[model samples]
Target: MSAYTIRDATEADVPAIARVYEHAVLHGTATYELVPPPEAEMLTRFRAISGDGYPYIVAEDADGTLLGYAYGSAFRTRPAYRWSVEDSVYLEPSAQGRGIGLALLLRLVELCGELGFRQMIAVIGGGEHRPSIRIHEKAGFRHLGVMEASGFKFGRWIDTVLMQLPLGEGRDTLPDEATYPGTLFRG
Candidate 1:
């Protein structure tokens, strides 16, 4: 809604993404990890997402200041779980309250649904992260309850809230890159 552009991420956006993620790790309970990964390691993780034909996108201004990013990746390694994906989204500390996270997440759902995903999952911190929960619910994800005390971080136990959105009914087949190469998203 603010005219930011969404595009598939390449290796070059790694540093911007890492910086945004680092802010969350340091200040917010959104991510359970204690220490932020180095830029190099972060790039490695994103590269794995790209290599798997998943969606990794960046929201940016015309001059390329990153506002936020969202992406979808395999929920589990097993082939049986290929049609379901776990989604991750993060906004720059300076970008919150401006709808960047919602915009990024909406685009993620667009891409995931087009790429043949049947179900999308979001894992959020319980109670303390209401903004994120509201964003996902606004975008149509259903609350699937919490995993109590599932993670230990910042010297205390944390709860994980799982939410999911089904892309659509049927369409259970796997993604066909051969038939749909270079198209960003299609219904």
Candidate 2:
């Protein structure tokens, strides 16, 4: 068996999730936020995602230390966008280069597909952030395009890269609208 485990994140994991994201916000261009959000804020965001019936999961080692997290959020708030989702993944240093990130992402893809989502997009921050891009690529995502100089952080302009993957049928076949989930989406 692998040294790490991947599972759905719970409320109790918020602190560790915050810590992982804080590392990225402070030291890496993987995220553009210059300041780390507080733990409480992280909890609120986590609750929102879970409440929306989206998948929020984490990776942990044998000792149960959180290594990273990955989730699928609404790609857009519009009703038409309900079938699409955008992926967000964050990996703590301990989990980097070990394929744990890929495992987490692929799992999110699987869960989202089961939830009736048709498309998954990865909006990676920092155009140069290849490891994140590679993880998405490894999950079968394809390059869409890049938005140059869209964000200014740390005294430099950062680009956003876009990649997309088709979940079940992609666009080859029309969805059976009657069987869709979240039909009552109050969002």
Candidate 3:
């Protein structure tokens, strides 16, 4: 087990987060983006997601080194999907397999559920990405399905794996409009 602390992300964390994501985009199949977005673009995205009242967090060591980050964002732009969120987690290469990713994910799920989200989805980029799939599974996500040959990256086609976890009351009960995360969607 690694020693780290998880906390809400601030603008100061964007640069480190961008570096982590850039490595993934450039060398891993976890994301389909062909080109890594620069820090400014990543900052823009961070503000958009956090501004929507979603949870974006970072994990850091006692020495303040960022190990990884995770966040929840609207699953889709449609109003009907307001209660569902898609989660993204990324870790520094050195931090992989150190239990940091799972920690970030569990925390993201807790924060999203607290904010009234009822469903969390993990869109694993490569069907063969066992570590991601295992992390999701460990955090209670169930295999939803897979999209075959849905992405072309690194000179080859890759399949995407879908996993889902129900949060809060899930679909067992109706959401209170006063506290629903959808309230953030309303202008």
Best by lDDT: 3
Model 3 has an lDDT value of: 0.93
Misplaced by over 4 Å in model 2 are 183-187
In lDDT terms, how accurate is model 2? 0.89
TM-scores, each model vs. reference: 0.87, 0.94, 0.97
- Error (Å) of candidate 3 at residue 182 is 5.2
- Could you tell me how far off, in angstroms, the CA of residue 124 lies in candidate 1 after the best superposition? 0.8
Q: Model 1 scores what on Cα lDDT?
A: 0.82
As a whole number from 0 to 100, the lDDT of residue 14 in candidate 2 is: 99
Clashes of 3: 0
Error of 3 at 126 (Å): 0.3
Off by over 4 Å in 1: 170-187
C-alpha displacement of 6 in model 1, angstroms?
A: 1.5
Candidate 1 lDDT, 1-187, residue by residue in tens: 3567889888889999999999989887888888999999999999888777789999998778988888888777766566778899999877888888888899989888787677898999655788899899999999899999997877888889999998854265555545432222323
User: Which 10 residues in a row give candidate 2 its minimum summed lDDT?
Assistant: 178-187
Quick one: RMSD of model 1? 4.3
Better of 1 and 3 by TM-score: 3
